[model samples]
Target: MTRPRLLPVPLAPLPNELIGSYLNRLADANRLPIRRIDALIATGRHHSRDKDDLTGWTLSSIERLAALTGRNSPALIHALPSLAALAQPNPLPTPPASLTPTAWKTKVCQLCAASRGVHGLAVQRTYPHQRICLQHQRWLGGRQLPISPRFHELIRANIRHRRLLRGHRDPLQPSALHDEARTMTSRWFSNNNGPLELQRTWDDRLQMLNPDTESDPHDDRNLIEMVTYPETVVLTTLLSKPHNPVHHDFLAEVIRSFGLDPRSLPALHRHTTLPSSMRNPDTPSHPSRHRPGSKSTA
Candidate 1:
């Protein structure tokens, strides 16, 4: 039996030592263990050392990585053809050296809205619901060969309610068959900038939007579950507060949970009463009205 010939990992062959050196420096500065270093190296290698693969990072991430590597990612990206040549079966083609990283990401056929999965043989989604990626999605998406149940569900969700999934609402038309209350509900959706999510389609229309024709309005309850907030923002709103007091305790809990300083919060002063609008037309009398006889000697 013949022993298999093993290929040695090629470290020294990388065109520019700059990124490699900085990665090494990071390993040293962070006191990164050998395992961590190997993982990092493997990660870079897994991409087949393609420069465009490197550019897939958000520009901000690239900037941060540059700060880490002590080399400008933009410059590194500019030198990509030379760099990517080191990788076999280079995924990107050699074009004019003038292309920039952001330009490259923007140019990649994958990002083009027109080329998405439903649009492709892959049957994978072009637009992800804030999670999942195109490749595995394609492999699993049976349309490629074996169809994906998840892809079907996702497509059904998107097609069944395209506008709603995108957080848009349906247009309500006037109909006398519906009562004034129902009319108000439909128009409310128009006013609130909705085709709310499937669940929210039944939420109270009195606040911001109108009820939908999609489901029974009478059954509406607890429609806030679908809400997903941005990572940086934390909403700590009050709930189940007293009608009269407006419940200060719940408000405090919200503030505490939000981790927002009251000082930074907008000033809110409570008024014991509404505006009286009383007009006092009194002019202070000079010395004449001031107890004329009391200080008259002055």
Candidate 2:
């Protein structure tokens, strides 16, 4: 049987975009209902109650979607990470286990979506470490907080994060380091026990990111995460290296590099060991505490 003609307008998929999101954009572009687009690509009986569910697509359906969207299968697979699994002969089972299931998906930066001609909500699967949109200087994991490009440390941290993900031999090490760093930083931020200079730095960032008010009720936690991100990344990088000793002097020097007093951290003052996660590389890291809309502080 001959397939239906391709849509007149072609929409490009954003990197790491969900296949379902692409279909919705495709439907919106052609003024078709999402179900109609789904029907066009559906190869057999659909099992998902939600039409846009990721599990709905198969290799055959991806081919049909390629035909309808005027894109090749490889291109579709490349643009949508989930499609690569569906293209496999024996795909992994559904409901992939995650410590934080809701965090597996995140909103894409609106500016980035608009650049691709998408002006609506665009969600993509994301790893825990994927937080900032270095391209647009916006926070991807939470309510939109536009950061200034002048924050060289934050930008450099984002770059290092990308490199860590790409270059690390052990896939789990980067995430472990990031999680531990975030935990430690969050503890300090919440306790309000960091050095006076460090506290002022965070306050400065909070003010800059939320200039309209003394504080933003909606963005406080996210702001805290953003303010601490550079330090978090720096600590992560230091711990990721095997040669970097986790001693008081080493920690003190790192604090001094940020132009903050090291003695302010009680851990440093007492010369206690760093968190076990930092000391032992094999320690299982906890899930990130910075999930969107989470009321849990730190």
lDDT of 2 at 163: 86
- lDDT digits (tens) for residues 62-143 of candidate 1: 4444443456555545433334343334465543222111111111122322343212111111221222223333211111
Cα lDDT over the full model 2 = 0.66
Screening candidate 2 with a backbone cut-off below 3 angstroms (N, C-alpha, C), the clashing residue pairs are: none
Q: Judged by lDDT, which candidate is best? A: 2
**Candidate 2 worst ten-residue window by lDDT:** 283-292
Candidate 1 at 136: error in angstroms?
Answer: 0.9
Q: Which ten residues in a row have the lowest lDDT in candidate 1?
A: 271-280
RMSD from true fold, candidate 1: 22.0
Count: clashes, candidate 1? 11
